[model samples]
Target: MAAIHLPRTIRIGGGVLDELPEVLAAAGLSRPLIVTDAWMQSSGLLARVEALLGGAGIAARAFTGVVPDPTVTSIDAGCAVLAEGEHDCVIGLGGGSPIDSAKMIAVRRDRTIPELKAPHQEDSPGLPIIAIPTTAGTGSEATRFTVITDAETDEKMLCAGLAYLPLIALVDYELTLSKPPRLTADTGIDSLVHAVEAYVSKRANPFADSMALSAMRLIWPNLPRACADPQDRSARAALMLGALQAGIAFSNSSVALVHGMSRPIGAHFHVSHGLSNAMLMPAITQWSAPAALPRYAQCARAMGLADDSEADQSAVGALVEALHRINADLAVPSPRAYGIERERWEALIPLMAQQALGSGSPANNPRLAEAGEIEALYRQVWH
Candidate 1:
């Protein structure tokens, strides 16, 4: 049996943010809590959204405190805002942090204690959520996963369930026009990893495979152009659409080795999620390639590195080389180069390996890694 799920409504284009009021009204939501970050708030994007909502006669309250790598404390704060405002819906209006924070807010709205938030816990439909993504990475707008930090432990909690998927997703490429080159590159690579991991996951089905392949084709070619010129609307649009598709693919299927290994680095070292993924991507792919040759070959073809006539192993090798090239071209740095202390990184290897295993993601990989193997891969990336 094959199961594929996606958001009920997705609006995409250059100016689709204008459809917010109509979209919300059609869904029977009136009052909305706008979840965003201080940067977007300071940049006036939040106010612009408010103005657009006001013009369409929808009332909204803004909570602009979500930080990067959203912590449980941040979610708690946003939920407080939602409660006081008595919002009927939530509008997540920034990148992954705000969107992930908003998802948790929706889940925690009725809960009294914040610590009780778990992936498996059920919440009464608190409020409908509309995810409006400003960046093309993380794909939190389309996925059911929301990574929240345990502030006390400094560990990332990868909570996921059906409830986290947005009721609607509004993807406007225009919003990403101002994204700097580093962010564009990192996030674009993150999207690529999502598609690649989904395609090679044990849970992958025919439906997700199609989406994953299409997403790779869309993202691989346009990422460099978008990075070089942030104002390239067409490239930006392609990347955004690719990211959305990759989110749906991974949401229904799963993300394998790269994501499983990437989270702990983010939690322990405070590295950005996409950059961590990029740092570990080449090594992880090389490690897992022997297990899923045909699928990796398809990925190579999608990235335009090979064709049907090429040997599967050769094509997979090409894919890995291409990823390394992308990393070098985009200036993706190694952990050592990114400034993690060598001794400290080695000390945490065992704990990070255990945490990665505990997340239940490595088991979904086409070739599952034992603790020792996962530890070795971490060491391999040290340089």
Candidate 2:
């Protein structure tokens, strides 16, 4: 038996952001602290959103100090702001970084990273969160997971539990309209990885399977189209919905090795999360395919890379090829190509492998990996 979890409220589509005030009112939320990055702050999107909230008679303040690959330090700053403002609610108003920062700020209760990392984190759910994502990637608006980096250890901590789940998600595809081409590619691949990993994870169940398949079906054909032409409204909407559905699926069923392995790279290399996942996808899938041939075939069919008439083994091969093609088209570089020096990468390999194992996500992989195997896989992705 398995349990399912999700945000209670999910408002989707373009121009749906105009309804944020009523959504907040229905939840009895007032005085929201909008956590976001500097880009949103300078771009006037923050001010515009503030105007909308004010017009709705809601009192909200913006906390725009967050940064990419958010650190414990950043979360502490957000927490201080939240504490000083005496906010009654939290609104994660950017991409994954700010949303994750918001989640940590909401869930922290004098708990250190070690304490929170424990499988059993006993604490109140903290402030109610209403997430509004500007990017089509991360699906952070709808998930129970948040990644925060530990400045001291340089480790990306993957925190899970219902406490981090947002109470509401307001997804407006219009927000993603201005995202550049590279971002569109990276985030799109990340969403695809989420759906595929969830569908094949050890904890997967029928309900999760349905969501994962749906996400794959939506993301596959449309991600490239959206990447090529940012003005494509329908493609953008489909990608947003796909990212959300993938977030929901992975939240319930959990992610496997690709995520487990990808995190350390993001933490150590300062590489973006989605690009890290994209970098590892092909090699990891090729190595893990034998353990779940049929499932990989299903993913191939979902991605439209293989058909029902294909043999399972051939379908798996096609899936691996497709992942490579996507990465190439997206211009995702390998660790070496991305400019991580060989000496530094060599030194970090052991720690990266250890961190991935400690994350506990790799344990859910269809074919469980030993640390040695993980180290080898890391080497494979380097060049």
Candidate 3:
């Protein structure tokens, strides 16, 4: 039997951010340490969360030290803040970085950073986390995983298990209305990758399949609209729901090669997670479709790129083309175009490939690759 895990509570829709006090009360949490980034603080979203808490006689504090691809040093700082307060819960208020920071900070109690890395399942509960996602990508609100970076080594550590899962998710599509086209594109593509990878992963289960397919259906159609017009509430709502579903899908079934390979690019070159995924997606999917033809075909169908009568091989081809088209249309730059030095990228391929394998995600791919093959794929995508 397949196992499933989810947040204890999830609230979705427009203006759901206003329900924080009631949600906190329901979870028996009063004082919260809001974990967020400087952007959130400057944008006044952090204050809004604090105001919501204040409305219910609940006092809250905030740590706005989060950075893109959250680093262990940042988490340590957040942990220090958490220690200073009697925060019954941690409210993660921003995108994936802040939410991930909140998750890590809540559980970091006395352990060293390396102690929380994958292959070490942190099943024991930490301070409860209430995730408030402003972006429709990363789906950090619904996932049981978090990625933190080691600034010294530039390795993105994928931490897993129940402790990282949020107790509640406040998903308000309205929060995404202010997002610019680039952020919207990258995050939207990130969600799409989550769904696509989860659906094709060897760990796929019926529960995850259902969510993944639904997410694909929603995301593939709505992403462009959301990017073109941030005020498109219907598109925003669809994308928000799709991202949540994709997060749940990947969290349960796991992400495969795209994610495994994407992390190192993010860590080493400081590429955003989703854009890295986009850079590798078309090439990797083309390479992998042969091993899981029917599965890839189904993904094409789910995205409405193919129909029932289409041959699996043909549909898989279409899926690859669609991925490339999506990237081109969204202006996703390749490693070379994005300004990563070619010599450095080539030199790091072996190390990045090794790190990808170490992540345990490539093993979940329908077709497994050794370090050599992964390095070749990296080289292929460089242009």
Candidate 4:
């Protein structure tokens, strides 16, 4: 049997933020907790959101301390605010961190103890959540997964369940207009990896495959343009939509090697999720391609690197080269170049590989890799 899940309502366009009141009304939520980050608070985006909600006579409380790679402590803190305010809904109004934090907060709101916050343990229905993504990465707005760091163990907990999916998603491309070039590139590449991994996953289904292919086609051509010129609304729009589509695809089908490997790096080294994904993407793809040639070739064609006459292997090569070119154009720095010491990175390889395996994402890959293969891939990225 095939199971596909998505949000009930998705509002997208240039000024979709204006529709939040009506969305909340339809959902019967009048008081909401606005979860965001300090950056968004400082930039007045949170205020803008509050004003819009206030204009519609909706009451909201703001909790704006979510950090990148949201930790369990952070979720608990936000949940405290939610409990105190007696919020009926949650508006996640930033990038991945805040959106992810919001999901967890909603899930854990009824829990009086912290021990019950583990994945699949909290069985209560979460409050209604409306995700507003300011960045076109992570697609947390559309996904059912919420990654949070375990404060005690310093391990990233991949908490996932249908209850975590947002009730509504508001994707407005204008919110991403201020993203710098490097962010555009990193997040755009992250979205691309999500789509490709979803397509090549052992769990890939007909529905996810369609969404993944469509996301890749939309993102590949427009990411560079968006990176080169952040003011290009059309390019930003395509990238935003592509990221959300890829999120929905992977949320149902699962993310494979790259994400499995990427999460540990973020947990241990404090690297951004997208950047860590960027670091391992090329190497992981190269390693996994042979096991899923037809899917890789399909991805190549979607990226416009394949012709009917070209061999599948040749097209895969072209695809890899094209990715390298995009990395160069975007100035994606290698892990070594990004300044992690050789000895330290080498020391953590075994542990990172173990954590990656424990995350269960690699099991979903078309080519399920053992710990040794993951370690080898990590070594390959060091150089």
Off by over 4 Å in 1: 110-124
Top model number, TM-score: 3
Q: How well is each residue in 1-383 modelled by candidate 1, as lDDT tens digits? A: 78666778999999999999999989998999999999998888999999999998877899999999998777878887877877788889998999988888887745533344333544345567799999998888999888888867666778777778899999999999989999999899999999999999999998888889999999999999999999998999999999999998998899988888898899999999999999999999998989989999999999999998999999998999998999999999999999999999999999899878877789889998999999999999998
Candidate 3 at 216: error in angstroms? 0.3
The collision pairs in model 2 are none
Least lDDT summed over 10 consecutive residues: which range in candidate 2? 114-123
Q: Kindly give the stretch of ten consecutive residues in candidate 3 with the minimal lDDT sum.
A: 44-53
Ranking by lDDT: 3, 2, 1, 4
lDDT of 4 by residue, 1-383 (tens): 56988889999888998899999999998999999999899988999999998899877899997998898788888988887887888889988989989988887745533344333544346888889999898888888888888766667878777778999999999999989988898889999999999999998999999989999999999998998889999999999999999999999898988998898888888888888888888778878899999899999998788977788999899888887777778877788988889898999999989988887889988888999989989999985
User: In what order do the candidates fall by TM-score, top score first?
Assistant: 3, 2, 1, 4
Error of 3 at 369 (Å): 0.5
Q: Which candidate number has the best lDDT?
A: 3
Q: What TM-scores do the predictions have?
A: 0.97, 0.98, 0.99, 0.96
- Lowest-scoring 10 consecutive residues by lDDT in candidate 1? 112-121
- Model 4 TM-score is 0.96
Task: State the C-alpha lDDT per candidate.
Answer: 0.89, 0.89, 0.94, 0.87
TM-score of 2: 0.98
Give the TM-score comparing model 1 with the true structure, all chains together. Answer: 0.97
For model 1 the local lDDT of residue 179 reads 94
